[model samples]
Target: MNQKIKRTATKSVTGVLLSIIIFSFSGVHLPVLDSTADSYFKESITKAGVSYGVCRIINATVSVIKESSLEVEPAGIGLSLAIGQIVDPINDMVERLSNVLVMSITSLGVQELVYEISVTLVPSIMAVVLLLLSLLVWLENDRLVKVQNVLINILIIASIARFCLPISSIANQFLQEHFFEDKIVKANAELARGTVDLGQLNDVQLPKYDGIIGTIENGTSYLKQKTIDFKKAIEITIENNGLIIETLLRLTFLYLGIFIIQVLVLPLLIFWFMIKIVNILFTSAALTAV
Candidate 1:
């Protein structure tokens, strides 16, 4: 009966994972497989180059979206990060609790906590799966099966943090820059006005006027006639934006920190903890050594 129950649980989990895989890939462009896949969307976009025509096109599309005369998309990028946090083993509990509280109050009634719960639930399930994988791996290992299972669990807990940090950083960046949209529009308008400021219209140096013969009026008129597209000030999402560029640069260090946590800190911590536990359990120098 116990074996049957375990098999049922395993099948259910497999079914759920398969569903998630289908959803993640749904509508995703793959040039080799789908007619809907645009050459650019199907292509890898690490950098701009002659062969990377797709990346260049991507850059152009982003420019259009960001600089849209229409209202911004209200899809709420922070929501995605919230989902990521729930899956994360190393969540900043304090911050999450605050978001949850605010979300609850604003939502109220049936809607309250529904969306929050939806995103947070995904990570929670993923964490359980990872934990189970850790347990199974430990049980199958013979060298220190009984003694170091707890250590393996700890390492698993620490390693999941790798996926969570990227999500949180993405969320945090969106939250910081969402308000800046207004400021960006206003700044672009001001820049446009300043460039077309009619006071210096005669200062422009045209083909007919040069070598100290340029007037302020000439300069102003010259600029007005120039075919610069000031309306297209914004051109990319946060991922490809200058506003989030500095924040992303800092996140580069955070990536290194995760690597350290995974490759060095986690291993050292698990080793030290297991050594102490093993010493206590076996109560013999020879056993601990072996």
Candidate 2:
């Protein structure tokens, strides 16, 4: 009789406390957590935009180089073919990178939408109703215990679903700040420099003479100057090829890291851990009841 009384009191207290918490949570927005998530989401969008912009600029520069013929000889020897060979692969990679950025942005937007819906009053009220049902089942005989467990499970899942993304977003932002910030900055810098270099390469043009005699009079000087300019352009292109390739690799790795953490790894891990904790708690409660 005394054990039964103690269990009843404990259940009552737990139910009241949970009810208060649920009511409070439903009535109020968690400003700190919400703001943090919003800030992180905005920052992620900005980064993706900047990356996309840089990629477009590079693509445009490469397109210009590929389309414009750089005649280095009178007999139709041009560097456009060589530029195309060098740039076609890089352009393809840039297009893929742009796609990835778009996907990342979309992922972030979806996450934000889910989070907004989860934290709204309707979900909170539903969770509260589930909690109340679980409490009522708790007060009943052991025959209804399984029903109570199901209600509790649903409640736990609802809670986790409501809050997991915001927590994960906070953690993702923290991880990015600690691990990826410096490297991303460096990668952006290198990409910007490479863009400028490619633009300069595109600007290198061979001087034109008026007519054949003028061409003949200045042919020697013209050939020498044009040769020097063409050689310089080739040198710039070769140098920029390695730099741009390295920078793109760095950006790809960094973005992949962010995507994995923000979209996949952290949220899944948190969800699994929360579910595990719920199972353990329920198992303990069951054992106590037995």
Candidate 3:
């Protein structure tokens, strides 16, 4: 009699819980969660856009340097060639960063789409149907127990898949805000400043020679001043080269960090944890049913 009463109480509780699950999935929306997810999605999109813009600026600066005839002759014969060697790798890196940013934006867009679909009537209806079927099987005999377990597992997976991306976005956003935001901002600023300085170097023009008569008239002083100018130009080129390389490295690492966190690491971790939870829930449910 005690066992019977306990079984009755367990069934009653399970029924109530199943009813609540069905109702939650019956086209009901949680405004707060949706709004928060939307906010995070927008913030991610904005950051990606800014990063891509910075990448374009870097590319443009590199292009200007590559196209300019910035030769400091005599003492700086291979100065432009050296700058080119330094910039070529950075150009490749910027191109790769742009591609990654584009992919990040696309992934965010896909996540938003998935979030929208998950909240709509279709998936909600499917979930409601699945819950009802599982509840019915729960009340029935053990003949269809395997089918019931399969349905439960499917529901669990579907639930996880439906909500994982939005939750991952929230997690990613929190990490970026607390950890990477300052570093990203500083790196972007440094890249911008470095690019501007690099572009200015292209404006350093070669001295114009008037004629042989005018050249002979100011020959000694002209040679001395020209040599000084050439040396100064070389120094500026070396300084800018160092600045560009350092900032480029910083920006590259920053971008890699963002990409890994937002796209790869967080999502995989969240999905794995969700799967673990599903396994625990499934095992407990099976044990209770037995």
Model 2, residue 137: C-alpha shift (Å): 4.0
lDDT of 3 by residue, 251-273 (tens): 66766777777777887899899
Q: Pick the candidate with the highest TM-score.
A: 2
lDDT at position 175, candidate 3: 85
RMSD of every candidate to native, in Å, equals 20.6, 3.7, 4.9
User: Whose TM-score is higher: candidate 1's or candidate 3's?
Assistant: 3
Total clashing pairs for each candidate:
18, 0, 0
TM-score, prediction 1: 0.23
Candidate rank order under lDDT? 2, 3, 1
lDDT per residue for candidate 1 within 1-290, as digits (tens), equals: 69866875675566456546534543343343222112211221111111123222323433333333122213234432332332222123222332432332232222213323323444455445444543454243575554445544443443333223223323323432453324433433432333233112223221333335554546765645531322122111221233223322333333333334422354356446655664565567557788
Best model per lDDT: 2
Give residue 169's lDDT in candidate 2 (0 to 100).
82
Give candidate 2's error at residue 42 in angstroms: 1.8
Which candidate order results from sorting by TM-score in descending order? 2, 3, 1
